[model samples]
Target chain A: MPSIECREIYFSYRRSDPVLKGVSLSASPGEMLGIVGPNGAGKSTLIRIMAGLLKPQNGSVLLEGLMLHGLASDDRARRIAYVPQDYHLVFPFTVMDVVLSGRYAHGALKIFETREDRVIAGRVLKWTGLENLADRKFEDLSGGERQRAVLAAALAQEPELMLLDEPTSSLDVNHADNLMALLDRLCSDQGLTVIMAVHDLSLASAWCNRLGFLDQGRMNALGEPARVLSFDRLKSVYGDSVKRLDLDGRIVIAPRGKRNTNA
Target chain B: MLDMDKTRRKLVLACILGGLWLLACGLSGLLIGSTSIDIVRALNGSGPDAQILLVARLPRVLLAALTGGALASAGVGFQALLRNPLATPFTLGVSSGASLGAASAILLGLDTALLGSAAVPLFALAGAGLAVAVVYMLARRRGSLLSTNTLLLAGVCLAFFFGAVMLFLHYLADFGNSYRMIRWLMGSLDITDIMVPLKVFVLTIIGFILLYSNSRRLNVMSAGEEVAQSRGIDVDKVQRRIYFSGSLLTASVVAATGPIGFVGLVVPHVVRMFTGPDHRVLLPASFFAGAGFLILCDLLARVLIAPTEIPVGVITAILGGPFLVWLLRRQVEN
Candidate 1:
């Protein structure tokens, strides 16, 4: 059974303009679904509705056949963790303290982290390769390291589902590749369902099993990567000419036709 | 486990700082007045000047400490709740609301005696509450909380409005009452006894404890509203509680001491720089540091011009304005 199902979700920030226009999608457990869209396409909004951060005006979101919108915030947090792209650490919070906050939904009144929670947070940090940086100030870390810390915090929730919005936007090429690979492992090894809104169509093609293309607050298409990553659909949705090439068993999307040589 | 150790260490250090502050301020407050009463003789309650020292200087020092601590702690909560580093009690219209309340009461012939002291504080509290409610309402419209920048702008505008109202009242007041209103506007620690400010002090302690008890919640809140909500925190409820409680503390103190400046803004940031962002540490540290900081400032206010005591606000502005500028330069340099 799918871990999440959204039915005709409609959302709008302003009354006249809709952000998500009846967008509906579903993801099975352990599946990595990548939502690829251009700017202002409501990719993040759809993810937020799925993660129960924002309520849909007309549609319902269900987790395991249970309506997610009706559940309490802690219940949703216990089952899923959402990591947004921009994480600005305004204070001198330690890496461990920030990660330990992931366990907050489990124990609300426990101000100090329990030993068990600490062990879990530490394990997750180690998995995310941030164990050595546990004591360092979060703001003091490099951009890639900070993104890893964010991943560690999300992983510490022990969630069956993870939602990420542009997890690689702030990272360099190597860091982005490493992070996507790590997420892929988590999905396969732990049967964790992952849904991420990504801008880089190439990364999505490489890492995601399934793809959902959003355009103008609507899901234009949803299917396997090969089926959704076709040249025609890619060009239509993104308006940038994407060249799909088969390099052995892997598929890569290159900007073949859109490059302007006159510059 | 390490966090616990750090929390304990912070508590101990804050306590030490507070104790040293109180002791130094107490002695200075008692000894630096017109007569230069001896601290040892005052404490022993044996000198011919003992009654004057115990009754006058003792209450003044305690009031100054309490008012300072209250305003500073309120500052910390305001900053956290608003998620703006520039937030403070005075800037948020809390002091203006309180001052308006106090000034209104005084205009109605309540200033000649202590007959309406409790009433003045109550009205001041109400004024603060109303101003906060207005700010909250303005920041939150049509069901969503407003952004931090908008909230700050609204608070400043409301503060200015209240200040204008207060000025209008000042102009309409009689000659004798006008002089009293002008003095009160300058801010004084001239309460005859410790009871009124002591009540405010107790409220400050209670309010600060409530704020500190939820320090962990505050830590998560500092991340962002969506993150805090996604983490199971009732962000709206917590924000409302913080706003109400912080405003209560701010209004009460402003009423008690006629709006002393800069302690709330300066103390919290200084405390955060040294103690880090954990509210458990920040709250208590701000409390003690604020109390100590204000008392020391008050001591300067009295002795800087021995024969004619400058308003405590003047002392704080002179000290705090320069210190803040230096801090800003340091932040930029770092």
Candidate 2:
């Protein structure tokens, strides 16, 4: 009942240059979908639409066959949790306080947390490996730690769908792997539907169940990673500079890897 | 769980100091007049100068304290809601708008016996409300308030524009009316209208209590509007309440004693310095401190020229200007 489906989506920040053009996709509960594309492929725009943060100019987004926009903001917040690409802050709220704010959509009359609310927030913090940093100020945390804290905060909402926009864009290798593994486990163990736009092809291919390749605000391919990340599709979507390498059962597409081939 | 011990300690401190300040104001109001009276004899209600004591001095002191308290508390509310250190009753243009309304009433020759009594304050409240409405309409984006910079700039510009209108009205009024208007703008304590102080005092106390209870929410809101909204606060509703209460408080104070300056801006920051940013402690402290500061300023205004009173606004501005410079330097150094 909490499935998300988009039909004929179209959006643009400016009238002449549409960011998303007639894009349609569906994601059921408990599935992890990875979206990959070159820059300006409308990946971020699509995530925002799915998160209910942005409205599509033409077409509709439905959560379990119900129109998403018609629902109350609190109700939408309850069902869909969004972690944006950039979250800057000036205040120094504690990590626990940040996480506790996730329960905002459940009730409006009572703003303070109950015993149950604190327990849930604590549990999510523990789950996301942020229990040790509960008392630490959010701004004091590192990039990876901040991302995990945000993830914990989003998880505290207990939403059915989680939309993470480029979660690993600012992380180191160890952090990127750890975050991907965490998401993979959360998807499988807790049946959380995750739709993330990832820049790293290897990470997406390694963890995601399905992959969608987008180019020029249109979907080039939508299927298993093997089909979506195929050499022919990659060449068409990203130009001839993109080439796939097969070495010892690992697959990698070098964005500029071919330029160094003559070296 | 309540921290009863800390609360009790704060309460005791507030009461002791506040009570002392109140008594001092009352004594000064009586003792500094053209004819001084004995405090013990006055307290016993057997003093020979009881008529002047009961009629003139006590009312002026009480009116000053009440106006000061209201303005300071409203200043605290505006600063927290807007998340700006620069926001105050005067800086946000509420006082300017009130003065404009008062000047308008005078110029229209509506300062007659039948209508002048009520028209000034009512129109002042209306002017303040209209000013807030225009600022809100201009500064809101995507149903949220704009950044503090934009809001402060808009308020300052509107205050200047409204002040110009008020000055224009000053030129059209006759010499007597113009002199009255000038004194009013300079803000002097006048117990001639005791009923105004009594009405405003009751409303101010009630408003102060209601606002003090919501200080926790304001502390949370100062971080950002998005954070507050996501924490289950109906941001728009709370903001409307803050604006309404703050505007009314400034208007009432202006109505009671013309337009006092700087106490609303200065007292809250001074309160913040000692009490931290937690509004729970800061709000009540600012209220009392504001009353105390204004009483002292009024005493200075009286004794500086003895029997020929200087405007309270002049004293506040002279003191506040130097304090503001120090605060700015401190902020920069930090």
The CAPRI quality class of candidate 1 comes to medium
Worst 10-residue lDDT window for candidate 1 chain B reads B110-119
Residue clash pairs of candidate 1: none
Give lDDT for model 1: 0.83
lDDT string for model 2 (B224-263, tens) is: 6654544435566677677667777777778667788789
Off by over 4 Å in 2: A13-17, A90-92, A200-202, A240-262, B1-39, B46-69, B80-83, B90-92, B112-118, B137-157, B174-179, B192-194, B201-241, B258-310, B314-334
lDDT of 1 by residue, B80-107 (tens): 8888787787777887887788878878
- Cα shift from native, residue B291, model 2 (Å): 4.7
Tens digit of per-residue lDDT, candidate 2, span A1-263: 64788888999884578888888888878888998999989999899888776678898999989898777667787888877777654334567767766766665444244667677888998888998898787888999999998888788888888888999999998999899888888888888899999989888887788888888898877878877899888777777776687766666766675457675
lDDT by residue (tens digit), candidate 1, A1-263: 78999899889986669898888899998899999988999999888888788888898988989999888888888998999878875667999878987888888877666778878987998899988999899988999999999889888889989999999998888999999999999999999999999988888988998999999998888998888878788778656555678888678877755344333
Q: Give the C-alpha interface root-mean-square deviation per candidate.
A: 1.5, 4.5
TM-scores (chain A) of the candidates:
0.95, 0.95
**Model 1 DockQ vs. reference:** 0.66
The TM-scores, one per candidate, come to: 0.94, 0.80
What TM-score does candidate 2 get on C-alpha atoms?
A: 0.80
